[model samples]
Target: MYLFRLAMASLANRRFTALLTVFAIALSVCLLLAVERVRTEARASFASTISGTDLIVGARSGSINLLLYSVFRIGNATNNIRWDSFEHFAHSPRVKWAIPMSLGDSHRGYRVMGTSAAYFEHYHYGRGQALQLAQGRAFASDPFEVVLGAEVADALKYRLGEQIVLAHGVATVSLVKHDDKPFTVVGILQRTGTPVDRTLHISLGGMQALHIDWKAGMPAQGAGRISAEQTRSMDLTPQAITAFMLGLNSKIATFTVQREINEFRGEPLLAILPGVALQELWSLMGTAEKALFVVSLFVVITGLIGMLTAILTSLNERRREMAILRSVGARPWHIASLLVLEAFALAFSGVLLGTLLLYAGIAGAQGYVQANYGLYLPLALPSRYEWTLLGAILAAALLMGCVPAWRAYRQSLADGLSIRL
Candidate 1:
């Protein structure tokens, strides 16, 4: 305890250099921990993007491509499945529930998804959590009503009862729009930290009504144009959809259902287990994730090296101090122990400050990140693995401290009662 106080007092004497070292280490530690937390949470979010669904059925394509378009909304689908085919499997005894998805539209930059009320009740994410409305109610039988995702509403500053127009295509700056049939935002979903947060949802009837007046991929002109009110009286059932998700009555029947959907006579359909597909997609991204972690680790090592350099550099100037202590009944080992304690104190303080900085950053940016990137960064306590990482950092610091400690001890012994300078 005496040695610790002595070490701290010595550090206090060189507070400027000590503070810089601590700040450097704190920044590095904060960066490393931030990267790790994002990596873990991103993986969790990716895996939980779509849960409680047994099979995702879509037009035959690469599993990754299908998963990308269906769940992540990354790309366009090669083909659309007939709505009758969706009905065929939806009514099957093995299927518990099904949610049809009709994509390929966009509001501003956010993708527009056409689905049923069953979507709110059946679709789930993040540990089987159902979609909850943060404001207003879900779209009803009205073909002009739309539901906005958390990110979509927040980013676009939309409110319930406000009318918004959707583009005919999924482009950020779409030239063709369904301006004639403006939809009213009836609901806003809570943030889900998934692709869903970036989507604008509408009923299938609304989706069909938007295109009801179109002829051969082009909007009707003048006399042929159909207004939104006029389309309400027409049958607006969707003819096709990009994909659909299914929940099975029994987990054991998953493979059987997948096989049946893959071999369905109505169309060239593909069915995949959401969990397996998510894992496969995440595996492709593992290399990049590891690379980021390695980069953060190297940054921490650089910070530690800077600390080591600072300590070693100060040793020459403090040689006279060491010699005086040696002459005043301080053993060489006490000098070494003092250096060790100094290093430990610096590292411990850095770790603590870094943790605090991390939490502060999360608290400040949590809502913005979730609103913009659909990633929720929680300000929760560090995990066991994080504790292990901090421990490893301290251990590395201790190991590095030994080098300067040994050097100081040797110098103190050689310059007993004499100043080198």
Candidate 2:
């Protein structure tokens, strides 16, 4: 207890240096914890985005691209599966449910997806929770009715019963608009923290209605434009669909169904397991993740280096004090313990401050992230991995203090009964 008091007094003598050391470690700890949290949550968000769907089927292409466009909404699809393919699969005995999608349109920079009602029925996220309507009701069998994702509604400030115009061919600035026919927002989905939240959804008939007056990417000038009622009179059969989400009738037959979809002779198609494809995507992103982790480690090393320099540089002024303590019957071990104890206190204080900062960050900015990017940044309890990382940091802090402790031990032994200036 006396040695501990002596350590406290020694730290108090140089409070400015102690404070600087604490601040340095605190900043490093903040960066380290923040980066790890992002890594864990980002991967969780990615994996949970398309859960409960057994497989994603699309036109022949790499599994990565298909998953990217269909699930992540990161890129465009290479090609589209024929509408007949969707029909066949929907009726296939091996399939339980299938939802078709049509893309290549956007509303103010957000992707516009044309899909059937099966999307809301079969699509699930975050541990198989079905999509729920936050407000209003689903489309009541109307051709011009639409549903908005939580992000789209929030960003565009749209409400139920508001009218919206669809743009042509995914161009935000396109002059071509479906001005003749508008969609009424029938429903708004709750936040899912997935790509679903970033999309504007409508029925395939709505997509067909918009393109009725245009052909081969050109407007039919003489045709003028038709109203939504006229669109109902015309056949709304879709030739191609961007992709389809599939659910299997039997979980055990997933491989068989995937093989059948891949080998379907009607047209070249691809089937990908959502889990397997997500792992593949993570594998592709592992390099970036590793780089982030390495950068955090360097930041920690830099902080430790700053602390080591401050302690060693101040040793000259501390030598006289060390000699005085030795003259008062203080053993070398007591002097060494004082140094170690001071280092531990600095490190402990820094870790505490860093953890508080992290909590404050999550509390403040989590809502913005969830609303805008479909990522839920929850303030979770410390995970086992986090505890382990903290333990490692504590150990590193102790080891770092050993340098100054050793120096103090040597100084006390050499200056017995003599004051060193």
Candidate 3:
């Protein structure tokens, strides 16, 4: 205990060098913990992107593919499910709500989603949080009105009542545009740190109206023009939708509904539980995650090695000081314990500072992170695994302490006091 105080006092005497060693360890610990925290939060945010839905029904395809396109907006669907099929299940007595989704349109590179007002009412993200309007109201019966996601609205500088045209296809640089069918920004959604924040929402009718004049993906020449007023009267019912999310009144019926959707005679379809599909998706990415973690672990190891080197090098210079303690009745084991205590002090300080640094970085950059990657990294204490890692580092530091401590133990009473040229 006295040796611990003496060791800290000794380090304070060489504060400059001590601080440099601590700095190296601190940065390494910071990076290690940062990677772990981000990785964990990313997994959580990714899985939570769309929850409170028992199953995501889409045209028959791999669950991973369906999740990628429907939830992540990463790719296109193989085929669309008929609106009639969607409606049939949507009206099931067991169903609490359903939000039909139609894709294949883009606005300024952001994906445009066609859905009903039920989306604003039933869709949930990040633990069942309902979609909230940040600026204006949700799109109502108006076929030409649009709702912008927070990121989409902010990135494009769109305001309520701003008019924007959607490209014919999902391509960001589509050559064909719906110049005649511009949509008004009726609402802007609160940031959810999900794909929704980058999407453009519109009524399913709006999607149908946008292409009412096009035939086979091209504007039909000599075709009867359908103005917005005319579109109001025309059938806006969606022919086919990319996917639909369903919330059941009773979760016990999840399997029953999913089975019914899969066995439907109307069309080939697949029903995937979000939690199960997410786990399957993670299996594909698990290797890469482990690789990143291993790399961070090595960085922490290298930093500890550097701290070890600094302590060992400083031991020789402190031999004379050690001899002074010997003269003051300090035992050989006391010198050893003193050396060990200093290493422990440095490691503990570094770990403490590193943990703080991680939270500070997350607090400062989480907004940018969410806006860019749509992943929310919450500010929180070190997780169980992170605490385990810190414990390992301290254990390593204590072990590394023994190396220099042993060398100090070998110093003779007369040898440490005598100087050799």
State the C-alpha lDDT per candidate: 0.91, 0.84, 0.88
Question: Which is superior by TM-score, 2 or 3?
Answer: 2
Candidate 2 residue spans exceeding 4 A from truth? 1-9, 169-177, 219-223, 413-421
Q: For all the candidates, what are their Cα RMSDs to the real structure?
A: 2.1, 2.5, 3.1
Worst 10 residues of 2 by lDDT: 412-421
Q: Candidate 3 residues 1-421, lDDT tens each? A: 6777788899999999889888888888999998888788878878779878888999998999999998998899999999889989999999999989999999878899999999998888878898999998988888999999998888788899889998978776989888888899889999888899999999999999988877776776655767777788998887889999999999999999999999999999999998899899998888898898899889888888888899899877887999999999988899889988999999999998888888899899987887667777888778899889999999999999999999999998788788685
Compared with the true structure, what per-residue lDDT tens digits does model 2 show for residues 1-421?
Answer: 8887877787788999889888888888888888898889999888788778888999999999999888877678888888988899889898899989888888887888889989999999889989999999877567788899898998889999999987886665877777778899999999888889988888888887788788678766755767678787888878889999989889998999899999999999999998999999899898999899889878877887777778778777677778788887888888778877877787888888888888898899887877656677788888899888877887887898899889888874456445544
- Give model 3's clash tally: 0
TM value for model 3: 0.87
* Candidate 1 C-alpha lDDT tens digits along 358-409: 9999999998887656678988889999999999999999999999999988
Q: Distance (Å) between predicted and true CA of 300, model 1? A: 1.4
Candidate no. 2 TM-score:
0.91
Worst 10 residues of 1 by lDDT: 412-421
lDDT of 2: 0.84
Error of 2 at 322 (Å): 1.3
Superior by TM-score: candidate 1 or candidate 3: 1
Q: Report the number of clashing residue pairs per model.
A: 0, 0, 0
lDDT top scorer: 1
